[model samples]
Target: MTNNSIAQPLEQAKSIAEKTVYSILFTISLSHLLNDMLQSLIPSIYPLVKTKYNLSFSDIGLITLTYQLTASLLQPFVGMYTDKKPKPYSLSIGMGFTLLGLMCLAVASGFYWLLLSVGLIGIGSSIFHPESSRVAHLASGGKRGLAQSIFQLGGNAGSALGPLLAALIIVRFGQGSVMWFSLFALLAIIILAYIGNWYKGAIIPKTKVEKVQVEKHPFSARRVSISLGILIVLIFSKYFYLASMTSYYTFYLIDKFHLSVQSSQIHLFIFLGAVAAGTMAGGPLGDRFGRKYIIWISILGVAPFTMMLPYANLYWTTILSMIIGLIISSAFSAILVYAQELMPGKVGMIAGLFFGFAFGMGGLGSAVLGKLADSTSINYVFHVCAYLPLIGILTAFLPNLEVKRKKIA
Candidate 1:
C-alpha cells in the first residue's frame, strides 16, 4: 500500500481506540446499581430485622460490622491480585455470591444467620468494587474523574432506592419478601458477564517486569505515601459522617419528628437521591477545573449544613440533610480519581485500598455510633459526627498533583 493509505488506516484505528467507551461505562454503572442495590438492603431493613429479632442497637451495629468488615478486609488483597493478573469474569462470580446471600437473608431465622448472610453479601462487594473501578478507569479514554463519577452515580441511585424498596416490600410484606431482590442480582450477573467479555478482549498481556516499569508514578515514594495517608483520613471523615446518616437517619427522624417508619424511610430516600444527583456534577467538574478544588468544596464546604442538621426543625432538617448529602457525596469521585492519578499504574490497588478503607470506616463508625446511641442518644451521635467534615481542612495540605505533574512534564 502507498504511504497515505497506510497512514489513513492507522489514524482511524488510533481515533477509535482513543474514544471514551460510554456503553461499557453505563453498563458497569448499571451493574453497580444492581450490586449496591442488593447490598443496601442489609441496612435498609435494619428496623425490620431489629424488631423481628428483638435486637438492640448494638446488635444492629454488629450486623453492620459483619458486612462491612468482610467487604473491607478482602478488597485490598483482591485488588492487589487482580493488578498482577486481571480477572475479567470475577465480577460475575462476585454477583453469584450476592445472589446466594440474598437467598440466605430471605430465610435467616436468627441473628447469627443474619450476620452470615450479610457477610456473604459483603464478600461479593469486596470482589466487585476494586475490579469494577479498574474497569471504569480503563474505559475513561483519559476522562478519569468523569468516568468514576458516572460509575458512582449508579451506586448512589441504588442506595437511594433501597430504603424506598424496603419500605414498600419489607415493611408491608415482611422479611420473606427480601427474596424478591434476587432478580436484581441475577440481572447484574448477566450484565457483568457481558462486561467481562469486553474486559477480556481489552486485556493486553505484558510481563511483570514490563508492567511494573510502565506503572511507575512521577512522585517520590514519600510524597505518594503521604498523599495516600491524607486521602485515607479524608475518607474516614466522609464515611463516618455518612454512616450516621445511612444507618441512623431514619431513627433520627422517627425520634425527633415523630414520623412513622414509612415517612422516615421516604426522607432517607430523598437525602440519598440528592446524593445521587450531586455525584454527577463532581466528576465532570473535576475534569474541567480540578479534582482538588472539587474535593475541597465537597467535603469542607458542607460543614455548615451538617452542623445545623441536629438543631433544625423537621422542615429545615430535611433541607439541610439534602444539602449535606449533595455536597458531601461529590467528594468520593474526586477523591478516587485523585488517588488513581497519584499512583498511576496501580489502579486496582489504589481503588481497592481507598474503597476498602471507606468500607472499614463506615463499619467502624456504625458500630461505635451504635454503641454511643445505646448509651447516649441518636441525636448525640449526629452532634459528634457533624464535626467530621472539618477534617476537610486538610485539603489545603494536599499538593495539587495534577498541577505538579503538568509542571514536571
Candidate 2:
C-alpha cells in the first residue's frame, strides 16, 4: 500500500500532466495566431481606413485609444475573476467576442462601428494572455522560464504571421479579405475550444485548489497601479516607434525612402519578422539571464540605434530596423514576465495590463509621433524615440521585485 501504490499513481499523474501541458500549449498557440491577426492586421488596414473614413490625425490616434483603452480598463477585473475561477471558459468567452468583433469589422458601416468592433476585439484579447499564461505556469512546474518562453513564442509567431499574411491578402485579394481570414481564424478557435473540451472533459471544471502563500505587498493595489503607470509610460514611448512601422511604415517607406507600395509592404513584413524572432528569443533569454538585465540591455540598445536611423542610408535602414527590432522586442518577453512577477497572484491582471492596456493603449502613441512628423522630419521621430527607452532602463533600478520559484501562485 505504501511504496509501489504511491509510485504508480505518481507516474500516472506525471503522464497526465505532460499530456495536459502539450494540449494547452497547442491550443494557446492557435489562439494566439488568431488573436494576433485580429490586432496586428489593423496596421495593414490603416491606409484603407484612413481613406474610407476620411479620418484626421487625432481621430486615428483616438481609434487606437478606443481599441486599447477598454482592454486596459477591463483587464484587472477579468484577471481577478479568472484567478478565483476556472479560466478556459474565459478564454472561450473572449474568443466569442473577438469573433463577433471581427464579423462586425468585416462589414463595418461607419467610424463608430469600426471603433466599436476594434474595442470588442481588444476586450477579447484581454482575456487570453493572462489565463493561458497561468495554465502554462501550472503546466511547466520547475521549468517556468523555458515554458513561458515557449508559450509566449506562440504570440510572437502570430504577430509575425499577421502582418505578412495581411499584406499578402491585401495585395492579392483586397483589404476586405483580411476580415474573411479573421473569420477563418475565429472558426479555428472554436474548433480548438471543442477539442480542448473533449480532451479535458469540460470547458470549465470544479477542482480543489491548494492554498498557497499569497503575497500581500503593502498598498498592493497602489503598487499594481504604480507598476501599471510605469508600464503605460514605457509603452507610450516604445509604441511611438513600434506602431509607426505597423501603421505608417508603408507610407513612410514610399514617401520618404522612394519605395513602391509593394516594396514598402515587403519591408514592413521584414520588420514584423524581426519582431517575431526577437520576441521568440527574448522570453527564454529573459528567464535565463534575469528579466532585469534583458530589460536594461534592450533599453540601452534602443537609443543609439534609433538615433542612427536618420543618418543611415536605405541599406542601413534595413540593418538598423532589424537591430532595433531585436533589442526592443525583449520588452515583450521581459516586461510581460516582470509585470506578472510584480503581481504574482493576478496573472490575468498583469497580462491584461501588460498585453492589453500597455500595448493597446500604446496604439495612440503612433498618432502623436505622426503628428510630430508633420512638423519635423520623420527621421527625427526615430531620433526622439531612441531616447525613450531610458525610462525603462531607469525603472530597472526600482526595488520592489520579488522573484519566486517555478510556480508563481
Candidate 3:
C-alpha cells in the first residue's frame, strides 16, 4: 500500500476514536430522564396513596422499603454480569418492565398491589441504571465526569418533573391517571433500542497496543477497599438525608406550614429543579478541578444549610431546601466518577455498587424515619436528618485518585 493510503485510514480511525459521541450521550440521557420520571411517580403520589388507602406512616415507609429493596438488591449483580457480557438491548427490556409496572400501578386496588407495582418498577430501575451508566461511560470520549453529569442531569430533571406532573395529573385526576405515564416508558424503550444498535456497532475491537497503556492503580488493594468504604459512608449520608426530604417533606409542609398537597408538591419540584441544575455543574467542575474537591465541597458544604432547615420559616425553608438540594446533588456524579477511577476496569461494578447502596440507604432511611415520624412528628424527622450531613467529614479520609489522560487509537 502507498504511505498516503495507510495514513488516510489511520487518521480517519484516530479522528473517529477521539471525538466524543455526544449524540449517544444525549440519547442515553433522555432515556434516563424517562426512566427516572416514571420512577419518581411512586414518591410523588405518596400523599394521594396515603389518603386513598388510609395508610399509617409505617405503611408508607414499607412501601418505600419494598420499592427501594427491589431496586437496590440486584444492581451490583446486573452490573457485574453486563461488565463481562455487554447487554446492549437490555435497556429496552428494562423499560418494558417499567411500562408494565406503570399499568399495574394505575389500577392497583389495594396497598399490596401497589407494592407489587412499585416493586416491578424498582426492578426495572435496577436493570436500567448500571447498564445505561456503562453506555454513558462508553460515550464519554475520556470526559467521564462530564458525561456522567449530563446523564444524571436527565434523571434529576425527570425527577423534578414528576411531582409537577403528578400534581397536574394524578393528584387532580386520581390514581388511574398514572397509566398515562406508560407512554414515557414506551418512548424510552424505542430510544434505548436505537442506542443499543449504536452501542453494538461502537464496540470496535481493542488493539493490543491500546490495552497495554491503560494505567494501573498506584494504591494498595487495602487502601482502595478502605476508600470505597468511605465513599459508601458518604453515599449513605447523602441518600438518607435525601430520603427524609423526598419521602416526608410534603408531610412536613402540610403539618407545619398548613400548605395544600399541591402547594407542597410545587415546593418539592423547586428543590428537585435545583438538584438538576446542580448536577450539571458537578461533572464539568470535576473534569476541570478534580472529583475529590468537588466531592468535598458538595457533601460537607451543604451541612450548614441542612442544620438551619429545621429552624427556618416557610420562605426561608423554601430557600434553604433549594440550597440544600443544589449543594448535596453535586456529590453523586463526582463520587461515582471518583469510584470508577479508583477501581479501574470495573466501571459497571462500581456504578452498580454505588447506585445500589444509594437506593438501599434511601429505602432504609425512609422506613426508619417513617417510624420516627409516626412516633414523634415530621418536624423531629427533619431535625434528626439535619445532622446526617456531618458524616461528610469522612471525606477527609479518601485518598485522591489523579486524573490521567489516555491516548485513543
Candidate 4:
C-alpha cells in the first residue's frame, strides 16, 4: 500500500473516533426535556392545589419534602450500581414511572395522593439524571462542557415550558389536565428506547474502558473530598435560592404585586426561560475559558440581582429575576463537568451525587422558606433567599482543574 493511502485511513479513523455525536446528544436532550417537564408539573400546580385542598404553606412544603427525598435518596445508589453494571434500557423504564405519576396526579383525590404522585415522578427523575449524564459524557467527544450544557438546556427549557403549560392547560381545565402530559412521557419512552440502543452499542463497557488512566489525578483523595464538599455547598446555595423562585415565586408575586395566577406563571416562565438561555452558555464558556472561573462568575455574579429583587417594583422585579436566572443558571454545567474531571472514572456517581444533592437542597429550601413565609411573609422569604448566593464566595477553596484529555475510542 502507498504511504498516502495508509496515512489517509489513519486520519479518517481518528476523525470518526473523535467526532461528536450531535444526533445522540440532541436526542437525549429531547428526552431530558420530556422528563423534566413532567417533573416540573408538580410545583407548577402548587397554587391550584393549595387552593383546592385548602393547604397551608406548611402542607406545600411537606409535599415537596416527600417528593425530593424520594428523588434524592436513591440516586447515588442507582448511579453506583449502574457504574459497575450498565443498564442501557433503564432510561425508558424510568420514564414509565413518570407516565404512571402523571396519571396518578391527574386523579389525585387528596393531599396524600398528591404526595404519592410527585414521589413517583421524583423517583423517575432520580433514575433519569445519572444515566442521562453518563450518556451525555459518552457522546461528548471530549467537549464535556458543551455537551453537558446542551443536555441541561433541554431540562431548563422544559422547566420553563412546564409553568406556561400549566397556566394554559391545568389552570384553565383543572388538575385532570395533568394527564395530558402522559403523552409526553410516552413520547420520551419511545425516544429513550432508541437512545438506549445507541447507548448499548456506542457506550464504553466499564470493563474495557481505561479505568486507571482515566482516573489519574494529582490531588490526594482528601483534597478531592474537600473540593467536593465545597461544590456541595455551592449546589446548596444555588438550589436553595432556586427553590424560592420555582416553588414560591408565584405566591410572592401575588402577595406583593397583586398579580393574577396566570400572570404570575407567565413571569415564572420568563425567569425559567432566562435560566434555559443561561444554561446553554455555561458549558461552552467553561470549555473555552475555565470551569473554575465560570463557576466563580456564575455562582457569585447573581448575588446583586437576587439582593435587589425583593426591593424592586413589579417591572424591575421581573427584569431582575430574569437577569438573576440568566446569570445563576450557568453554574451547574460547569460544576458537573468539573467534578467529572476531578474523578474521571466515576461519572455516574458524581452526576448522581450532585443531581441528588441539588434536588435535596432545593426541597429543603422550599420547606424551610415556606415555614418562614408562613411565620413572617413571602417578601421575607425572598429577602432571605437573596443571601444564599453569597455562599458562592467559598468557590475560592476549590483547586483549579486542568482539562484532562483521554482516549475516546
Task: Name the better of 1 and 4 by TM-score.
Answer: 1
The whole-model lDDT of each prediction reads 0.90, 0.66, 0.90, 0.90
Candidate 3 wrongly placed segments (more than 4 Å): 1-17, 205-210, 403-409
Alpha-carbon error at 25 in model 3, in Å?
Answer: 1.1
Q: Residue 368 in candidate 2 has what lDDT?
A: 75
lDDT of 4 by residue, 378-409 (tens): 99999888988899999998887753332212
lDDT of 3 by residue, 1-409 (tens): 8999966756665555456799989999999999999999999999999989999999999999999999999999999998788888999998999999999999999999999999999999999999999889888877899999999999999999999999989999999999999988989999999999987866553122124435777778999999999999999999999999999999999999999999999999999999988998899899898888998999899999999999999999999999999999999999999999888778789998999999999999999999999999999999999999899889888876663333211
User: What overall lDDT, based on C-alpha atoms, would model 3 receive against the true structure?
Assistant: 0.90
User: What TM-score does candidate 3 get on C-alpha atoms?
Assistant: 0.95
Give the TM-score of each candidate.
0.95, 0.83, 0.95, 0.94
**lDDT score, candidate 2, position 121:** 79
Error of 4 at 91 (Å): 0.3
Which 10 consecutive residues of model 3 have the lowest summed lDDT?
204-213
Off by over 4 Å in 2: 1-20, 191-236, 374-377, 399-409
Clashes of each: 0, 0, 0, 0
lDDT of 2 by residue, 1-409 (tens): 8999866755655544444466666666666766776677666666667777787656666677777676567776677776676555567777777777777777887789889988887777777666666666555543555666667666666766766776677656755575676565567578557644643542222121212234455446776677667666776667656766666667767767898666777787787777767766666777677776776677666788877776778888889888887778767667777776666656656665566655654666666766776777566666676667666666664433535333343
